[model samples]
Target: MWTKEFFGTDVYHLVSAFVIYSMLGWLVESIYMSFCNRRLTNRGFAKSPFCPIYGFGAIIGYLILHPLDGHFFKLYLLGALMATVFEFLVGNLMLKLFGEIWWDYKDKPCNYKGIICLESTIAWGFYAVIIIVFLHSKIIGFIDSWSFSMGSRVCSLILAIVTIDYIIQLSKAFGIDIRERCADKYESFKARWY
Candidate 1:
């Protein structure tokens, strides 16, 4: 079908993993933040309702921790360190590129450049154990059950939509407010009604 293998793994399955993990991560973050802030916040870099960081992190975690699936103690300890490094790098990269910090942990204890904190890193370890023990098998099986042809087609569709959303969000960063006109219209309509 498409060009070829995506870094050895089948492109379809890889993308499926991204979409699944991103969606689940987004849901969890949104729900958790809603309770913490007492308001809805769609936490992610993209306009679409998923965080690629979580997707990438989950994939990376799965790759590294899957082999140690039954060993919770080692898995948790190593996973925490790996995830902390990943989180720090991603945070720093985003800050440099966007001229904004997506998150700040400076207020928390044992933080580094507001990119990460001890508590969060330990929490990542807990998440790693859960993913390795509970989610990895189910997600892998679900993706494997899909025929490549069918799976690729579906992955292509979802990836296309996500790519477009990413482009739009990038444009917004460059003073291209694609959403401005629609938002203004909505405000006027609301004013007239209420």
Candidate 2:
């Protein structure tokens, strides 16, 4: 199957988890930003009710750090470290690609180039503990309750819609040739990373 070929076993479950966490992340970020700014703000890059970065972050935490599960201290510390690094990289990449930083911490204390701050990093640790310790089982149960066919169909539909929205929003936001920008940024990223 395409799922097995592209991803390892249980691809449906993983994708379901990613989609669920993404919508939740979008909700949380939207509410938080609205409250902070005293106005409603759509925090998602696309018009869809999704936050892909959050989905990826959660998946990375589950795959890489779940081994530390039960060890709260280890999970928190490592989750914090991993998430901070992820945030820093994503924040910088967004700036380089879009010429805009999605979130800035310039006014906040202990911020590194306004890309990440101590408070947010600490919060990520707590968020990690919550997701791993509390939400993991529920998510597994939810995914398993669905038949493979149903789960795959749902996830595919959601992902397809989100991808379309992302493409439209990308063009509207930058008003430039995305291919050119991507090529230039890819070269820059390659040079920097390599």
lDDT of the candidates, in the order given: 0.85, 0.88
Query: What are the runs in model 2 whose C-alpha is more than 4 Å off?
Result: 2-9, 176-194
For model 2, how does the per-residue alpha-carbon lDDT over 1-194 read when each residue is reduced to its tens digit?
A: 42653233366677889999999899999999999999999999888989999999998788887788899999999999999999999998998888878888899899999999999999999989988999977988998898888888899999999998898888878786777888999999999999
Clashing pairs in 2: none
TM-scores of the models, in the order given: 0.82, 0.85
Candidate 2, lDDT over the whole model? 0.88
Ten residues in sequence with the least summed lDDT for candidate 2: 1-10
Q: After TM-score superposition, what is the CA distance of residue 112 in candidate 1 from its true location, in Å?
A: 1.6
Task: Give the winner by TM-score.
Answer: 2
Cα lDDT for residue 41, model 1? Answer: 80
Off by over 4 Å in 1: 1-9, 176-194
lDDT of 1 by residue, 1-194 (tens): 44357555565666788888998898899898889899998887686777888889998788777889899999999999999999988888888888877888899999998999998999999999988899877887998898878877887787788888997888888777767877998999999999
